[model samples]
Target: MRKSELDTPCILVDRVKLLDNIRRYQGYADAAGIALRPHAKTHKTPEIARLQVEAGAVGVTVAKLGEAEAMADGGIRDIVVAYPIVGSAKLARLIALARRAKITVACDGIDAAASLSEAALQSGLVIDVWVEVDPGYGRAGVLPGADLDRLASALVPLQGIRVCGALVFAGHSYGAETDAEREAIARNEAGTALLAAEALRGFGFPIESVSAGSTPVGRFASAMAGVTEIRPGTYVFGDVMMVKAAALAIEQCALTVLVTVVSRPAADRAVIDAGTKVFTMDGEDSAIGTGRGYVVGHPAIEVAWFNEEHGILKLPDGERGLRVGDRLEIVPAHCCAVVNMLDELHVLDGDRVGATWRIAARGKVK
Candidate 1:
């Protein structure tokens, strides 16, 4: 089908740009001698996950069991659930998944490790697990040192859980304006993780993998001495936030939402068919300037605000040329969230629709 025939609010991925991004990241990982495991939560499509693996990703990292299941069903063998799987129902599903694929999970607490171990024992499978260390985010990870050591020790007694390595996410350093600053923060975080791993080693545990990454931090993290794996998801489709934050160039952005101007409300105001539902409302917390999104083709037009179904566009006083029914593409402020909001994505090459891929793992929170 032609690009124009696709439904409104549909996610569009530029196939060429997406492939370029994949290769660029893979090249970095290869040169750095670290395994590239692009997070599948960004695209949530098994086809894209396969593409990543084909592009030299050692495996795919998913944020949830449902994503892992989808990738497994699509023939992906090496899968890592980057989040802790708790509760009986989710653990049961995780155990079932372990039987089909080489699975790994993240744990930050004794209870979670014990639960996972029990589940793995029940399934009669040994699952590789990583200890999530909190560098600074203060979210879902054990603090370095005593806390982490406690969790690692607790996992030793678990029958089916194997401590694979340490995982640290350096997301808090993405807003740095200078390259030196970003690198410094990344080095500090990596150093801290390496130290923690050394402590674990001193305690007689083998540390196989030292993974740390965030799209912005990954640019400098490749230089860290001990990191063995780097997981950065958004680098696959650079979004407006990443571009403005200096993580990627405009040309690197592979995703855009096609919207038609529905109204020219005033000389400086216009309205587009895309809104909060289409363009994610995640720009407020971004390091870049606050805005709904950026008009892909019109550099001067700013997406000032968005309602549930309409986007308010503000054109420069004398730059109001867009008329009603005019189609314009927009790069979302955050591509990952935008992907989650849609059920399918249209793969396009230039203006032609190349393929259609379902967002199979959308809303897989459990």
Candidate 2:
């Protein structure tokens, strides 16, 4: 069926644009001599993960153990749980997941690594782990100086876990106001991880992989020497936030939410069927332009506010032709969060619905 004929507040992904995005980034990684490991947290669908793997991604990266499980069930053999997996309950699950695939987990401290080592020893399986280093994100990771030295020393005695290398996330690049600033952040991110890896190797640790990158800084981060792999998620489906960060052009946004104008309360006010539940509240703290979402082809229009089930739009002046039952496409502020709010994505074949892919890893927060 045609997109216009579909139900309101549904997702639409352009097939041609999607494939182009996959190939374009894969080509960049191949030329840079760095492995591309597309983070599955963006699409969270096994089918899209397979497409990335087929296009040249060495494996897929996930944010949680549940997402890793979904990918493994979908026949993906190599997976990376980029986040720390703590707690005994989760260790058991992580060990079980290792039996199904070559699982690589991350840790920033000796405690988590020791826990993983104990679990792997009990399961009689060696787990590959990348030490996550803080790249000024102020999130979860050890600093690149004496602290990192201490952690590396502490983890060296863990027999059940193998220290692969260091990893960094250039997430702070999202706050960059200019292209130069973003590139600088990317450089620092990769450099920090590489430095950590070098220190680990000097400490008699077998440092094999140095993974770093995010969608905003993936290109610059991958170009840096010593970065073995780059994990970018949002590059597969561009969004308004990415456009604002100068990482992607607005036209590269393949995924959009198709919503219908449910009511024209006033000449300047138009209400949509979708709300925060659909588009999410990701761009609230941004100093950049645009509101909750970017209205496709309607530059003057802004998503003024949203309730659970209602989206308020401020229309442009002059001939305001938007009426009830009018369908509008919105490029969400954040594609990853928006994808998690849906059950499936409607792939478009031109103007018709081509296929529907299940969001296999949505809500897999564990």
Q: Pick the candidate with the highest lDDT.
A: 2
Distance from true location, Cα of 337 in model 1, Å: 0.5
Q: Cα lDDT of model 1 overall?
A: 0.82
Off by over 4 Å in 2: 284-289
Model 1 lDDT per residue over 146-260, tens place: 8777766766667787786888887777667788877887888788779877876766667898888777777765677798888889999888768765778876899988888
Per-residue lDDT, model 1, residue 35, is: 87
lDDT by residue for model 2 (237-323), tens: 888888877767888889999999999989999999999898878763222444778788886788788898999988778527999
lDDT of 2: 0.87
lDDT (CA) for every model shown? 0.82, 0.87
Misplaced by over 4 Å in model 1 are 284-290
The residue-level lDDT of candidate 1 at 323 comes to 90
Candidate 1, backbone clash total: 0
TM-scores of the candidates are: 0.95, 0.97
